[model samples]
Structures are given as structure tokens and as C-alpha cells.
Target: MLYNLYNEKKDNRKEKFWFRAIFYLFLLIFIGTVCWIFFFSSLLKINSVEVIFQETQTEYDLFNKDYLISLVKTAFQTESSGFYLDHISRANFFLFNVDHFSQLIEKKSLWISKVEIYKKFPQSIQIIIIPRDGAFILQGEEDFLVDGQGMVFAKKNDFLKESATLPILSFEMKRSVKINDQVLESKSAKFLTIISSIFSEQSGFELKPEFFTPSLISNELEAQVVIDNGWKIFFNTERDPVIQSKLVRKVLDEVIKEKISDLEYIDLRLPGKVIYKLKGQPINADDSDAQESKSESKEKKDDRN
Candidate 1:
């Protein structure tokens, strides 16, 4: 009877062990089903995308909508590492990488300057595109439209109306530029623009805008504005362009005063003075008989005296 009781206890332990094993197996299957429903299922996949563009100054045709849509769609379908395998669909809303997509768009599209992305819950995406606009025209071996940030975006032939109206800046030699390249420094471009507007308004003649930025040397870092009357004016780029402009206006009104034909060059690079050279005399000539009207900076005056 004691032996029979021991056997009964052993059999009871075996039954409990089987029951625990079955319960654990069912729990694992239930957890796996939940993971499949949330991750590998079709309910959370992205099915649609909407693209909105910021209004740009250039023609709408410059930014192609179909190309942009294709790029976004391609980004959405990119493959990701799976939980069980190497390939999985990135179309799922939770798996989509927004930062990577934005960078991809900006990198590939030259017309696009900025991009914003939004994910609509349950199955859609929205993106906004901001395009680059022409700020000035740089004429060289080829002409290009440059934005305020100094990036070249399009060719001149592409925008005829804009090319006609905007200020034209040229180098002495041809500039090798392609789309999406920075052709000018922002500071230099702004200085040239200010000088152009001021000269056009005051002198009543458009400048042959050739900016010489060859070196750090003072002589090479000058703005040469050739007037219609066959004379020139030189401005120091390192100096304040506003003050130089004021001095130019003052000399035009008070000193030169319609004597532009006799003028060789008005050198405003000098501070507190306006130096004018005439056609007959050489530049930096001693003002003895007054063929060249002289305005000298303190250093120059000290040299002459």
C-alpha cells in the first residue's frame, strides 16, 4: 500500500509538468500572432502620398511634380531589415524614415532648396517643397541664375523675362559653373547689388559691372564701373560700400557736377576725400596746374606735402 501511494505521487507530478508546458506553448503563439498583426500586416502600410510646393518666383515648370512624386514613392518602398529575414517593406508608417527622405529629396533635386515632411496617421504622407529663386544673373562663358544664398540653379535661356530685368554681373574671364554650385559669396553679391542700384539711380547710366576679386591685395579687390561717357570709377570693396556711395553722390553733385567727360576715374577708396583724374594727365599725378582735380586721404596728403 505504501509503494502504491509513492507511484501515485510520481504520476501527479508528471501530469502537472505536461500542463505547464502546454500553457507556455499557447502563450508564445498568442504573442507571435500579435506581433504579426501589428508589424507584418497590411493595415498600417502607407498607401498614398500628397506633395505641396511653396510658391516660387520662377516658373512652376522649373520644379517637376511627377519627378518629385516618383522620388518620394521610391523612398517609401525602400527595403528594411526584417525581424525574421533580411528583407521587409518600409511602407509601414512606423518604419518610414522621415529625415532620410528629406535629405534624399534635397540632394537629388537641384530646384528644391528646403523640404518639410509630415506623416498622417493610419496610411498617408504629406511633403512640402520650397524651390530656389533667381536673385541675380551671372554672365560668363555661360549665363546662370543665382539665388540670394549664392547657389546657381538654372540657365539664363530658361528664364528670358527674368534675365532681361535682373542685374547682370560678369567676371573679366568666363566662370565655370553648373547647376547647384555656389558661384558667389553672399557678401560679395550683396555689395555688388548695392553698388549697382546706387550707381544706376545717381549717375543715370548702367555700369559695366566687372568686379575684380583676384587677390587679397588692395588693388585687385576693387569695383570698376565703366560709365557710358568713356570714363571709370573705382571703389574699395573692403571699405563701407554705403559711405563710398555717399561720397560718389556728393562728388557727382558738388565736385564733378556734369564734368563726367573730363573724368578719368573717381577714386573713393580714400577716406574723407574724393580723388578725380582727368583724360590728359596720368593717375596719381601731382596737382600742380590742376588738369586733375585732387581729393586725397590723410596718408596721401601727407605724402604729397
Candidate 2:
């Protein structure tokens, strides 16, 4: 009995030793994990921030390394420490609120492509931006620069002072052409192409429309073109646009040859017939007089009977 009791005590002591060993091992592991999380994990640390821009303009001060560092510090102090790890950060938060950013950029007259954010670690955030490429100016009430896709880009400070001799688009902003949507109608596209070609071909020919009016004949898809010479040219989209353009060129050549400065209107809707209204001709007046005379003769004959 004494021997059995001693063996049982020895086993109990061994078990206790193993339990203590396991407890100490677990404590060490937990401490190591905490240390790694606090010191070694990148989630808790930021090192350096890189700010990149699309065109690297002098206007974007945030693109500067020093400016970006200061911004990151400011954001860290104002925002939560885990802001970088969060779904949205100060750098990319602008993207989610695109309308706000767009408005801000417009208000500041600055163009932007994209704003990107990257976490370097202990306290650094990288902000990258891609700016829009300003293409042409849309001449209207609020004249603004338009990109290739007809998207209105933000204006720069020098944009107002310095005139960029880009091609002008005579497009009436209708409900069909939404603010953020692209107007890709074949007629409009073709007209723009023709205007571009004209500008490319002749340096003297600048695009200046007398008035941009829409017509309901083609579901308001057609726009009347009036040049500086008071020559009204009807532009139809259903017909072959290239052919119509050629006809217009022919008529212009003829007008120059004939020395015809005054023309009422030129109708190019028909294929072969070019109905042109001549200057100094009483249109509809003669017809009205003839109808009146015929009615008077009919009344006299009725009186005689």
C-alpha cells in the first residue's frame, strides 16, 4: 500500500509539471503574438508614403513628398489610427464621394483622373492621382473644356487667361445628352469629324455657328447649320452624311463662283434635287395674289349668272 501511494504521488507530480509547462508555453506564445502585433505587424506601422499624379502638374501641391507627408500626418491625427486598414481611407475616401470631389475640383478649376491610396506602414499613406487630359473648349453659357469622350474637365487658372485655340463644338445640350453621359450619335460624331477635318484642311475656316437650332423632322436629331454668310444649310442625319457634306462643299464652291452672297436656304434632303431659295424673290406672295385673283373672277362669273 505504501509503494502504490508513492507511485500515485509520483504520477500526480509529473502531471502537475506538464500542466505548468503547458501554461507557461501558452503564456509565452501569447506574449510573442502581442509583441508581433504591436511592433512587427504592418497593420500598426507606417514607414513612407508615395504620391503619384497622372500629369504631375505644378498646381497639385499634394503631389509633393513633403506635402503628402504632412497630409498623412494630419489625416492620422484627425482620423482613427486604423483608418488605413479600414475599407476606406482618407486618400481613397474621395473616390467614394465622386460627386463631392468632382464639385471640389470644378470649384478649384483642377482636373483629376483618379486618386489612389497605398499603406506603407507605422504611419505613412501614399496618395496617387491621375488627372484628366483637357482636349477642347465647349463654347456656351458656361464654357468649359471637354475631354475626348465629351466629358467636361475642370479648368485651370491659366485656362481663362490663355486661350487654347481648340476646335469648338456647336452642340445644344439637350436632355438626351446627359451631363455625365456620352453623346455618340452618328450625326453628331460625323459632324464633329467633319469639323475636325475642315480645321485640319483649312486654317482659315474656323467653326462659328450663327445659331444651333434643332428640328423635329428627324425626331429633333437634325440640326440646322447657318454659316457666317447667312447661308442656311439643312443637315439631315438619315441620309448619307458623307454625301451630304460633299453636296454642301459643292454648293459652297458654287456660291463662291456665282458670287452669291445672299441665299435664303439650301435643302439637301432630296437625293438629286437641291432646292435653293434665291435672294430678292417673293416667296408665297405671288401664290397668294393668284389665289385672290382667281377667287375674284369666280365671284364675278357667279354674279353674271
The positional error of residue 207 in candidate 2, measured at the CA in angstroms, is: 2.7
Clash count of each predicted structure: 0, 7
Specify the highest-lDDT model's number. Answer: 1
Residue-pair clashes, model 1:
0
For each candidate, give its TM-score against the true structure.
Answer: 0.55, 0.39
Alpha-carbon error at 189 in model 2, in Å?
Answer: 4.8
lDDT of each: 0.64, 0.47
Full-model lDDT, candidate 2: 0.47
Model 2 ranges with Cα > 4 A deviation: 1-178, 181-190, 199-204, 209-211, 215-232, 237-244, 254-256, 263-278, 281-305
lDDT of 1 by residue, 1-305 (tens): 99999999999999999999999999999898877766787777777788876656543243345655566566545532243354345677787788887888788766668889899987888888776665667777788877777778877775334324565665554556898887666666556556766766765655664555443123323455554565666676545565566566666676667766787777765544466787786654222212122332443567789
lDDT of 2 at 107: 46
